[model samples]
Target: LDSVLVTLEEVTVCFSVEEWALLEEWQRELHREVTAATEQLLASLGRWNLWGLLDMGKILGGSGF
Candidate 1:
């Protein structure tokens, strides 16, 4: 995993300025979509009491769903 991350970093560093800007723009868009979706799901879970069913301790411990 560490090696893969390093390789990805190196490759990203080689991108032209325009390419990098585009990549960053795409990443921001993806982040926005993901955050919106997560919020919507959490809201639904709350309505159904499913969010309360989850273990708070596990979530705080970084155990992602």
Candidate 2:
């Protein structure tokens, strides 16, 4: 019974670790997509010379990669 409990605990820990890793990977991918979209939007806005129409400082809020 003790061995069985130990084995179950080990499996649970392994499963949790794997789940955490998967979530981290998903977060990284999401960040990448958001960054790409932001860059593209910024480029388009720049090309149109419409930067003055929006408050970029408030939008970015100093949060960077």
Candidate 3:
């Protein structure tokens, strides 16, 4: 994640107010996609190993985080 952020910092982005609003929408979309992905991953793991997946779900704060 640190490496990804470092790469991001080197990238330049320019946004007007409208563009910023669009960017915010895109961020929310990405967040939802990420949440869905994590949930899928947790569900898949839970099916194979419920106990370990339960611990991982705790560390990930389940759906709250």
Candidate 4:
């Protein structure tokens, strides 16, 4: 998970048009995965760091990627 975040950060630093499109697709996929995981975690655990995960989704979604 840390590695994934690191790679995402690196990718966002600089990218060509093609790379940007790929990155946007990756970002959307990541957002979906995170949302699913977070929902499952909440259902099983009652409560957790949901705000952080949702905040991350918002940040990525808001970036217009």
- The estimated TM-scores of all candidates read 0.36, 0.36, 0.36, 0.35
Clashing pairs in 2: none
For model 3 the TM-score comes to 0.36
lDDT of 3 by residue, 19-57 (tens): 445556567466546645655665675533335434544
lDDT score of model 2? 0.40
Candidate 1, residue 14: how far the Cα is off, in Å? 25
Residue 65 CA displacement from its true place in model 4, Å: 13
Q: lDDT per model, in order? A: 0.41, 0.40, 0.45, 0.50
Instruction: Estimate, for each residue in 3-55, the C-alpha lDDT of model 2 and write its tens digit.
Output: 32222233211223344345566664665466456556656755323342233
Off by over 4 Å in 3: 1-23, 47-65
Q: Could you arrange the candidates by lDDT from highest to lowest?
A: 4, 3, 1, 2
lDDT string, candidate 4, 1-65, tens digits: 35322223432333344554666667856755655665575557555455554565455554432
Model 2, stretches more than 4 Å misplaced? 1-23, 47-65
In Å, residue 35's CA in model 4 sits off its true spot by 0.8
Which one wins by lDDT: 2 or 3?
3
lDDT of 1 by residue, 1-65 (tens): 35322222332223333443556666746644654465466567553233432433244342221
The residue ranges of model 4 lying beyond 4 angstroms of the native Cα positions read 1-23, 47-65
